[model samples]
Target: MSLPIVIIGSGFAAYQLVKTLRRQDTQQAITVITASCGDDYAKPDLSHVFTKGQSANDLIKMSADEFAKTYDITLLRRSRVESIDARQKTLRCNGESIAYQQLILATGAKALVPPFQGDAMGRIITLNGLEDYAASEVELKKAQSVLVIGAGLIGTEIAMDLASADKRVILTDRAEALLPSLLPDFVSAQLYQSLGNQGVSIELGTQVESLRQAEESIAISLENGHDYRVDAVVCAVGLRPNIRLAAEAGLKTNRGIVVDRQLRTSDPHIFALGDCAEIDGNVLAFLQPILMSANALAKTLLGQASNVALPPMMVKVKTPRLPMQLSGNTANADANWQVSASREGMTAKAFDEEQQLIGFVVTGSHMKQGFSLLRELPPTF
Candidate 1:
């Protein structure tokens, strides 16, 4: 009898892992459990729905039942795991204990919302998962204005979505510009202007101090002695790895559940991937890295002792208002860079001491060089 495989979490990693594994062995029994509704959708697409003229419902790629039927695997939608016993190879859910031969965790990350002063209770949302998106859609209907707490990729995308829906949007960040996590300073300037031109007021270098409730709305106060009254607030600060379960199960963990190049956790019977797993000491929160990790993990499950060697994975922002792609790590100390910028666009390339290209950033019109530049970069661990 083939051993039953159990997979936790239903995100890009989980879906792709199942697809890739089934392609190699169709008869293996597999089960997927998720806490949220199991309609598979691209997670990034959640923020840019309005720009693409797509509805929240339209974003669902496959229903849970359909996915299970299509892949010949069991799909447990809206099911939550309470505990995992790694020694016994058992998982507890809703008072039921299930045994598995091997376990895979695709438990993705959660939005990080810093603690701030506010009414003890108010309408605040985080754009982390599908449920969050559905809640945001409902909040937008009743909102006349919105206060966004972070101006990173997700925050900027959410602000732009709200603005396009004709709601007054105010985007604030502790950093001095949008795309601070991914784009360089010169590149950010163009994005700042582009968003500003579209009526999205950016309040960089500021933090949300508190939220005051009004009779019919809310007023958002910043630490810099500024106040703006708005209808609702959305927090998109950043993401934290979902590692509590793996940690509690006695698996080795650092910033995330530590995994090797083959995506296997400390326990050979257990594996971890996606935003929740730290591979080669790197927690990649981007799509390309996630895809590459899934493919490599699947190959290992198919009886190959393979290590996933990642090329410099590029980060692409779908802010159609300002499309940009960045490849490789920009924080390399051993590399010198040459930057080219304009009011419209910018490009920067980091070259090693030996004159080999190591990393790059592309913004606006220079985004066309993304592929060529990444092709020249050295492989990232």
Candidate 2:
């Protein structure tokens, strides 16, 4: 009997890959091993679940049993892959050895928790997966005020969500502006003001120095000499790709698990995608790139060589108080920002030295312009 194809995750990438692969080969033996409950849920919804009044149980899109039965695959929930024997084509999970013809590492990433002097580090919650969100819900129920660390995409969205839920939210970050890596100064400033107006206290250019247990709350001291006492804390600093298992097995790794255009790792039989993969030197840790990579990798596994070509994908910020859509390559450090703002909204376009539109940010009614700019921008790959 041939060994089954093993996938080490149950996130969007893993499940979507299985669905795509089954379309080509209906009878292929496939097995998925996940550390979590194996329930299917849109991870992005974790940030705004409070505003939607949805619990972790309500976020499940599909049960593990249903998903496995639909795809004709095996689902191993609450299982951790301890190690990988690359040469033997086997994985050790929970003291059991499982053989695989080909292995897919969709392990995804972990929420990055910044180090600080703190005895109350355990009190800080991070919303990364279903389990984390469940834990955070419990914490929120007992707290009236929340402190959020980081002003990036996830951090900002979480702040907005909490503020909308009527929780006193104080959001702080080390960066000078929100989403410093993704948005221009002017655009970020606009969002900063918008969030502030929505009753979220914005603290830019600040870093948490220490956290200590107060009388009934957590006392947080900032590097900027400001201090606050909050009932709960949520950390949304960022995510670091899960590459330990692959690296331990001698797989090449950089910012993430290194893979070729075909999503194959150093070992030809092993492939990676989603937040865990750095494909062709690009670590696109987002939904669109995951879908595109899964589609292309599915074809490759079915004996057809295919490469993922990602077009300029826009990111929709879920802050209803300040609706925003960002698209194209805004990471070009050499690009210049041409911004125009008014009472209606703000449109910030990025242009390279050659005067070509490389990226744009649109808020309010001007979001309609995103589609046109996206068409003009070049493919990300």
TM-score of each: 0.94, 0.96
Per lDDT, the best of the predicted structures is 2
- List the candidate 1 regions with Cα displacement exceeding 4 Å: 331-336, 340-345, 352-354
The regions of model 2 sitting more than 4 angstroms off are 331-334, 340-342
lDDT of 1 at 54: 65
What are the Cα lDDT values of the candidates?
0.83, 0.90
lDDT of 2 by residue, 4-100 (tens): 9899999999999998999899988999999999989999898788788888999999999989898899999999999999999999998999999
What range of 10 consecutive residues in model 1 has the weakest lDDT sum?
328-337
Model 1 lDDT per residue over 1-381, tens place: 766789999999899889888888899899898998887888888777655656678888998888899999988888999999999999998789988988999999998878878782356788787778786776666778888888888888888777877778899999987776566666678778878887987898989888877877887788888889888888888888999999999999999999988889999989998999998788987888788887888778867878888887878776777777888766465658798878667788978788887778887898887888888887887
Clash pairs (backbone) in predicted model 1: none
